[model samples]
Target chain A: MIGRMAAAFAAGLMLATPVLAADPPAEIKIGTLYASSGRYASISMPVHSALKLWVEQKNAEGGVYVKAFDKKVPIKLVAYDDQSNTATASTLYNQLITQDKVDLLVADSGSVLTAPAVAIARDHKMFLFDQTGTGASFFSKDNPYIALMADPVSTIWPKPVADFLTHDGPALGIKKIALLYSTNEFTGTQANAVRKFIKESGAPVEIVYDQGVPTETTNYTVIINNIRAKKPDAVIHLGYAPNDIAFLRNVNEVGVKFKWMFSIYAGLETELLEKNVGVKGLQYVYTYVPPSELDYPVNFGMKMPEFRALWNKTFPDGKVEFGFNAVAGYTTALVIEKTLSVATSLDQMELRRAVFSLSGQLKTLDGTFALDETGGQIGELTPLGQLVPNEHGHLKFVAVYPHEVATGKPVYPRP
Target chain B: MPSAIRHLLFIVVPLLVVFAILPGVYENHLMLFNFVVFLILAQGVNVIYGFTGYLPFGYVGFFGSGAYGFAMMVMHAHASAPVAVIAAGLAGMLIGLLLTPLLRLSGAYFAIANLASSLAVLHFVANPALEDITRGPYGVSLTATFNPEAAYWAALVVLALTLGVVVYLKNSRFGLALQAVREDPVSAGMAGVNVVRMRVAAWLASALIAGLAGGVYAWYVSVFFPDNVFSGTFSIFAIVFALFGGVATIIGPIVGVLILYGVYNLIGFTTPQYFQLIYGLLIMGLVLFLPAGLVSLVTRRGRHVP
Candidate 1:
């Protein structure tokens, strides 16, 4: 009886041992909200599905190994459908962090949706890894809890376009660039950033027409006609895939012409553009993404390529874009994995510290990166990608910007 | 048990359950306050749609006014929530009093008028002339939690007081007069019942409840904007509870509100997006089957319909 009592006491001590007393946590719970069932579902849902697949692949390899924990721990992703409603999105997201007790948080798809989530995360001192949301204010607003997984839209994106415009303008016999963007906070911020970047780059950017249109407006013939009438050196419009697809179809149909032209958003969507307009139509377009950072040792990071391969094998008929959306989801999982491996159990404060300390290379598909103190990237940079048609007709990941990541030379007067 | 003890037991049963799980159910005082706001609003909506004969479709309109009134006063005008609540009530009373003419009309007209009032308020809020004052659509933030416990306690007090008043009115002369107006205005008028007066009073009282609830809700939610404030769904939810509980009884809306709140939360835990669909279907079913509502079945045999 004495021996049994002693054994029972020993077992109880082991069971009751606090996570902090032992190795760091082996698993972390990430709460990510997205437009899973609403207007933004087409893009956001794919990111989520891709993310889930990445997590499964990681756990399959015995989870992430953190130096802090010195063990391989798995990852759990908790996603909520924002339904494209901001209020519902805000309330539900708050509940996740405060009530459901999630380890870390990931941003919802849109900027409007992410703003409140980011604010709440900052207030509570949680690491909010913002992936899909690209609004400039996210970076502008002083907060340490949030990071720009998708490089700040207003910060870096406009710079390259402006640089290319300035460098190639006089050389390529092009002069004027027209800026068009939506009225939303993210697009507006980008539009403003582009304008600022153009002036800094010594490019003559005459915004021929700056009109805000409603989200539900279907007919873009008039808008395109208005732009065509401007007849600038190039036309750069920023919007979602649906809006871009509609505008491009109409622009193509009307044979509206421009030189070295680019668009803001839809360039990243491979499937939507191909199904609607072929890759030939999308050739020469450039969009921003985390410099498809060359892969390193992290086993899960290596699995991204295989994940894409499996996706290709599973749905050969489908074509997906190689933009930052896929990277966003993958990055979130990476951050979660890192957090989990660093700790023995998912505790908010410990996970928060781990996220803050992420300064060196992160093995995300986007690239090796680190979130700075302000939750912004320290040295991580976004490189521009050109839509080069693969032999299979899908676009290749050909980085053509920042000179260093350039695979192919610029097609200056891209059609 | 004494009569009071029996009634007290009914309340205690749930109180004990909530007390047992309060720690797990709520993360902090802020969330508890949020629940309090919803509870108060549900009860107020119950009073207007459940107790009164009027179909006040613009329940949220009054609520919006109260929220903005408080938000505007405290954050912008540098006043407090307590003062803001009173100010919001006064504003609600003024609006309700102004709407006295519409109460002369019955059923659909009352609904249309109330709807028109809310939409008009919404449009006015969007007007650029007032944009500078109302902060347009960006909404005014409450800065911080701003006395969360106080807000929660206030909500509790309001709920208890409203329940008592509604019950007292249901059993008293004013309630009878209001019921007479609802049952048959012409007959009520012939029986020396000041039908219009009772209705107007009820309408004003209902608006008062909405106003107070809205003001409190603003402090709890911490952000007050026109679009969020004047949403028509508030009225729909109010109607759901009123019908669910047995609209005429003081207790009906409260019971219905609790059941639906539970239903909503239950569904919301897993999939929040489809909770509204469930709500819509449930309300439709209740209206179709139990015209008198679930609250009408005070007797055991009445529940045996199967």
Candidate 2:
């Protein structure tokens, strides 16, 4: 009886070996747990599509060489939706790591959703590259496995906006300013960062207003009335798409004017501006970004067309409007390509080490940023960008910061 | 000994030993602790529905508010968890007492009222008017409960006590009275049952259990952001387990939890989530054909088999 049981046990152990020994695929496939569904679907679906496009483009040109395999291996990304819910995102991230055993992971939008996924990545000894969803605190926190490709919310156009303030516009002597931000995680991060920047400068700060309002409340008349009453030097509003449009409409309709009106993220997403804010509404809203505006660096103004053309030809129909978000989305795939290129071996540890090393020296379309230990990108970039009228009567980039980058001098007092 | 008691000892005792050794389970299995917390919560819902026949579609509100209330107090005041548990229970009781007036009404109005209660609380907590106190949209985390095992043990203890309460209620005159009301309100009233009083008590008991579970969960997860804590998922767990596990049978919930958790673990439970559709299909089938639940179907079959 004992001999028979031992024989059965040995058989059971032998049977499990096949499943365990089923080595992961030769190609480095990253099963993505991004938001391809839910409200965030609009943002992530395009991002996954754009990422796949970049991968195809890279492969067609030349494959990424893996040092481990001593050969080039094509990368594959399998995408899924989190429904923009943290629990679901957490659950999906685990599946990607344990079952699918994705070579690498990409984070979905929103810090609230990404936090748990980051913990899971750390546990599984996998690299998670966060792009597009900017939350400054993620960079502020310490983690090894997670790397930052996503521009931190605090740095969402931080350099251009701040450069405009510190070097360019400060000399103009527009003293007091009013600060307004869409009440959300993204805008809150920018609002806090900007306030910190202003506070340290001691630039005769105005008491106009620095407040946040809900996404609802269609009528900004009451709040605008309050802001108009304060009558400070400039009016700054931080928001994304709809709020950006509604804020501009309410303030402009009420005839609220300032020397400068600044905005954050969504103000810079060109499509969001046209389809939502339109040209007339967002005429003078300024946005801030690091000197390296696009994900791929354009040291000179000349690079914009090639970048635009390549991006447009790739997604052609996407040209009605595009901004840093798409660029950041595209950059995530670029990071994977570069990571695979540097890894001397297919071993997970070697791949991770190569990524960490390769990422530190990356010069992206948006300019160069050093990848730090916690996986956040750090670039010595001048923060500046402003919104101006495009020929189509919509808002377009009018650099108004860092004196050097300013396309033209500041347009003060509204028009 | 009764065969049922023998069955309980055979099954429950071993399960107890396994749960006792659960802290040593792989780190990946930590999410199972979430269901232990969920079981306690579902039991609370069971009291309101199974024992008293009150369909509450909005218990998530009570659970969330109780959690946030207890967690914030502990964070701000540096209170102990044991103390916070009681405080959370009291907070839920207060909400139940406040909502008792709605119980005087009948029909779909009760369902609407319960759902409305959750929405009202959600709006109040989410709005900026209470921003200073609740921190508005930004939720407070329970940083104090960093020890993983402590959280698991705490959740387990609370669950045991809640089950004890359910067992006690089952053997009492109150349980008989509650069933009497559930069967026929007019008959219960004619027989001198204080239906309103009994319903109110059940609501209070349910709220207390919900509150205790919420506090435990908040501490266990170490973070209880408002939107996530107050989500409809909380209420759905209560409704799903009860309906799926043969409502009114106390042991039915344990079986429901086992099957549901197994499915969750298989697909939706893992990182790359895919089982949400399967979950919906399973629940839909249960609702459409097996209205009485899998347990009831087996029992009904057994009665006819002879």
Candidate 3:
């Protein structure tokens, strides 16, 4: 009788084993915001499109593997358009968290749009996959609900530029510098970093002109004339794609050429800048060497050549251009995919841990994925490079900073 | 019952009760919070443009000032959220007092001047020269003081107060005199209406309502830049909502916000791809067809709206 009773208990335990494991969800809902129009459209559309490409590719491949359920689950993307308005973005972010209850939340493209999501995500205890908002103010020791997935934090982004300016600049006869930036988080932080880096380097360079114009300032004829009066050897104008387009176009129109000109978007969004400012306008301009040009070896996701081919085929109409932001979006998608494969469950903190765990271990098309203790991205640093005209008169990047990666010598005193 | 008391019971009390109970039933408290904010702003517009006949094209200046005021008090003084909110209101009033000279202008001149003033304030706040004080476009992050629940309740209180003021204007002699000034300042002046005082009083009250709303908003978001708070959309949306519902009536702005902003959110959720086009068309149609606003449909038939 005892043997028979033990056999029956063992049979009952076997029957309940399946129930002990968590059931696989029908779909993993990922909520994010995008700006289809207004100020950020040029930068936002590419990132959003790249994210869509990843979603389609994964879904076509029967879905992604989630370790939590130990099975493949389809992705459900819940997205909203904020029209680049912060108040609207704030409302939509709250809607994504409360009403949608998505498993993962991703921020919009730029710092202006992402500012609203940081607070909203933290308030709801949802982890935010910040795409390209490199604002210095977002990361702190207290906030654990946010992590930057792409682009180095602004505090460290300009290291290559500063290093080049201080270490290699004086030898190249680039001593006097004029700094101009649009007054916003992304570029403003970069400007501050550049200033700090130069001062700390104790280089012979002296900053002759430093000024910040409003982000909405479109006319730069007066500002250009002001900078011209200082007669600096090198000029660094930190601004958005639109600001860069206006500033460069104004430079070309006004017929004043600086010896050394550096603008952020000239290399970062080369296609867009070339189309707007024309190939001649971007010639010999110094900018960051984007991931598209670097060809970083990847442990996962498509390589630069494959991704660019796919981006062109997917967006053949050419309304949006391929650039650094395009690469950034795919990098973020890879991080999410890898995180899901390793995360034990869909809990917010668990997801955060899974993300942080991949730091220094994961490599993608952008670069090695790494994060600081405060969740700021510390990897994927871009080297300072200059844009020079190739055989076909189209601009190509020539990495000139950090001598080890130096592809060519600096071209000073534009003639 | 007095007309003001009746309006309060029928309009203000029910609205407040519904909003007060909404967070428990619906999960999207931010959406509800936003609705409450627009209601206050639309009514604030009604107070000035509806009653005093001055179009505050730069109404967002006071709102932005209030937000900065709250930010300064919290960051500098380390004051609690409630005290910062009070300071925000005072900041708005101070700006209103400084611009009192604008009252000398009329019609388009007043409107353009107000708009320019708001833009001026935005530039001043965002200027990198003020980096030490305002953070100068680097943005503000108030993680320690972030209390969404308390801020939502404070917003509700501000809404209730705004509604009460509107109800008083609808029933009191002071309201009548302000409307009199709006209709014809010269005629009202001959009739001893004290045009300047009435207009300024209404303007200051309008500014205070927006200030309180802005303070609560800043407290709720807890992280923002100068651009976010100073966006011209605030002024544009408030004006559009008040105009759509037929300002001057207490319930008109509320109804307009509920219907229009509800549609706005619905479009944003359902068909976001065409949101901008559809919304633009809807506004143009409203102006072309329903020039006087939705309330005009009923008032045209010799009926009181409120």
lDDT: which candidate is best? 3
Best by TM-score: 3
RMSD of each: 7.5, 8.5, 2.0
Worst 10 contiguous positions by lDDT, candidate 3 chain A = A16-25
**Reference contact recovery of candidate 2:** 0.04
In order of TM-score, best first, we have 3, 2, 1
User: What is the per-residue lDDT of model 2 for residues A241-263, given as tens digits with 9 covering 90 to 100?
Assistant: 66666777787788767667776
Write the residue-wise lDDT of candidate 2 on B150-254 in tens digits.
667777887777766665566568887998988898899999999988989988989888887777666655543566567777788777886787665556676
lDDT of 3 by residue, A229-341 (tens): 99999999999998999999999999998999999999899988888999899989999999999988899999999999999999998887889999999999999999999
Candidate 2 lDDT score relative to the true structure: 0.66
Off by over 4 Å in 3: A1-21
What is candidate 2's CAPRI-style docking category based on DockQ?
A: incorrect
TM-score for all models, in order of appearance: 0.71, 0.78, 0.97
Task: Summarize candidate 3's per-residue lDDT along B156-193 as a digit string, tens digits.
Answer: 99999999999999999999999999888999999998
Which DockQ-derived CAPRI band holds candidate 3?
high
Report the Cα lDDT for residue A403, model 3. 85
Local lDDT at A348 for model 2: 60
10 residues in a row with least lDDT, candidate 3 chain B: B136-145
Candidate 2 TM-score, true structure as reference: 0.78
